[model samples]
Target: MAEVKSMFRDILSKQLPVEDITTMVLRKPKLLPLKSLTLEKLKKMHQAVQETTHQQEMVEKEQQQITH
Candidate 1:
């Protein structure tokens, strides 16, 4: 479906690794619903993922600095 393709495109554009996306979609069947997803909602989801990843990286860096 077009909505599914669009969702895949949005996920890819977020720079998520293909393996992770594949695993996530497989594990969470509810991720792709029958209803159409809005662009705004996709963008928000991407932004949230980016922010969470950034925060995680920062925390890891801080931990490494402390160890070194």
Candidate 2:
């Protein structure tokens, strides 16, 4: 758990490079198997991206209203 927390800190602090994100993920700890979980996570992440894009559009629209 400490390792996981340290990894998150590295990510949040940008101490880890962009390429290292892939490295960290692909080289995940042996305790948790992720061969199939990664794919499922990717799918869920795609959905989240879509939702965030929609929310961003709504916020932009509201900002336009506020300006005018």
Q: Pick the candidate with the highest TM-score.
A: 1
User: After best superposition, candidate 1 residue 31: deviation in angstroms?
Assistant: 31
Error of 2 at 33 (Å): 15
The lDDT values for all models are: 0.86, 0.87
Per-residue C-alpha lDDT of model 1 across residues 10-43, encoded as one tens digit per residue: 9879896678767633364456665566876898
**Model 2 / residue 54 / CA error / Å:** 1.1
| Pairs of residues clashing in candidate 1 | none
State the lDDT of candidate 2 residue by residue for 1-68, as single tens digits. Answer: 99999999888887766776676434655676556887999999999999999999999999999999
- Candidate 1 Cα misplacement greater than 4 A, ranges: 1-37
In the order shown, the candidates' Cα RMSDs to the true structure are: 26.0, 24.1
TM-score of each: 0.46, 0.42
